[model samples]
Target: MKLLQRYILGELIRVFGLLVVVLTIMLVFVGLFREATERGLGPVQILQIMPFVVPSMLPFTIPATLLLSVCVVYGRISADLEVIAAKAAGISAMRMLAPAFLFGTVLAVASFGLTNYAIPWAVANIERIVTQAVEDIFIDMLRTQHLVSEPSRGYSITVHDVQNRTLIDATFRFRTHDHHQITVRAEAARIHFDLERQQIELKLRNATYSNPGADSFGDWDGTVLHLPLPPQIHATKARHLTVADLTEKTKEAVLQDEIGQIQQANEAAMLMLTGDFHQFGGKEYSQLKGANAEAVRNQRRFKTEIHSRVAMAFSCLFFTLVGGPFSMLQARRQFITSFIMCFLPILLIYYPVMFLMVNLCKSGTLDPTWSMWVPNGILLIAGAMTLRKVMQH
Candidate 1:
């Protein structure tokens, strides 16, 4: 029994390792190319992020690769009559399948760790690399083109020359938040990025500013102007956050919603006591309701994200359970045919259901804690029935 388990496990590991490596490499290149094309990343930036990209791709690759490996190893063994030989030797089907289950359990835990921990770390590093690349691109545009315009950011910079890191005879034009158009001319200027604050600091020397709308002009020996960072550099998605961070953020969102509700309730009571019934449908009340609704959506989004991560990770085990028994049942067919028979349904049914459940969970139509597990539950039932059939025969 010990020898059989080892043999099964060794075959699974050998096949899984090869498939994962091939799949991960193919995926990593696709990821790199996408990032490069979308973010305009150069060779240096791509190389810098290459290492971090592997971890992000692993969680996606592991479960499918494990499934394929199971189909390959078990389908082959069964087709070779080894499973029947073991059964004739008084080994139960469950006993023979123990190694695959154990392997799947370990991979499931690993997949979860990759998603919950490794992914966050990799995303952070990738974002940092992309941020630096954007900064470099911005500086390069200013140096080569001698002008940079960002309509979305409401700013444009033109320079006579870029010497080293300094801009000589620079003119900066921008629109303020209050719709004020202003221009500043500087003898020399330097740009600095404050990533922590998500802002850019432009240090100017011998600067003169003019506001044509206000018909005002000013001069300063030196001053620093702050500008918003590019939107692409901002990483606020819940997927980029760790589970602990998501939990804290979810609590904060819920607390804000509760506070807003309480405030609105108190205001409504005050209006009632003062007989100001007309204020019940006021703009302030409408705004307060909107804010509360936004908070609720945010909390729901965070909860869904947390549950989806765990459910997606455990798909490794569920895929194994279904694939192993189903592959054995198809032992008369080729392993690839068996794999397609098993994976085709998953590709068609499992992912769509999971996607639908996630969207419903995010919209607050369903509770994420249970809804996210619907796909896995389907797989478990199918696996159990198939395993029973395998056992009886």
Candidate 2:
């Protein structure tokens, strides 16, 4: 029976590792293939960028592998009457799988760390690389003297002829957001693309800028002003930024229970009594007392994020205990059924808790801590019930 346990754990780990590799190749190729058409970078460039993209995906892939590995390996054992044989020999089915569940716990712990730390860093860099690639492509196009688009800010011109290190004929189109009409037509009497400063200088024989937001355009047909380009025009997109970067940038919006706040208040006010909002600290008191809605909401959101992380880590232990008695039923041994049963229950636990927590924060009914433990609590109760039944049998 001990050997059987070893055998099962080995087989499952092998399967899990193989799946991770296969999934990586498939996903990376798909990502590259899709992006290739629009970016038009050469193969060498794609290869260079693949390393940065792959690591971030592992956190998502690993959890899925853990779930399926337990299911398939345990399910098959039950199908073969192996559970009955083990039981007859005084080996409890649940007892036999103590090892596999432990592995799951380890994977979950690692995943939590990755989610918080490693993935965030990779995500931050992903954008920078992609941005550099796009800039390279645009620069390459400029060499052919094509009319390259400058990210809706204006048109771009490539210089092929120059006198005294000054550009000969450089003019980019400038337009309002509608883009239907060209707002500026300037042939640079002279131009210099400054690499050091990362900007293009257009010494326009004539230039014009249409101020669209003001519904006005100042008179100018022949002048070039050095305009500062958007630094991130060559920037990598959102995916490249790490979680910390995201947290730093958008934490303000996320906090404040902004999205569902109005809805929650409306629902609660219908039954909870409207004036209670004033007693807790009216909107006016919030200002004088420095107790604003945004701060409260932000605190709730942060707490929610913390609890959510803890609950996910706790899942590793929950899943392991589950695999134990499930093995006893011999029901857990079927590859197909076991995988489905194990994975589905987990998803059910995870998503609902997430959903409820978000709502609780919005509804003002749950603090972050209580909302997070809901999912773990449900899973623990379910596992306990199953374990009790299996041990009795």
Find the candidate with the highest TM-score and give its number. Answer: 1
Cα distance off (Å), candidate 1, residue 162: 4.3
Off by over 4 Å in 1: 160-170, 184-190, 194-198, 203-210, 215-224, 231-234, 263-287
Q: At residue 372, what lDDT does model 2 achieve?
A: 70
Task: Give all TM-scores, in the order shown.
Answer: 0.89, 0.61
The numbered model that scores best in lDDT is 1
Clash number for model 1?
0
Clashing pairs in 1: none
Judged by whole-model lDDT over C-alpha atoms, candidate 1 comes out at 0.90
- Candidate 1 per-residue lDDT, tens place, 261-338, comes to 998898889989999999889988888888999999999999999999999999999999999999887884487888
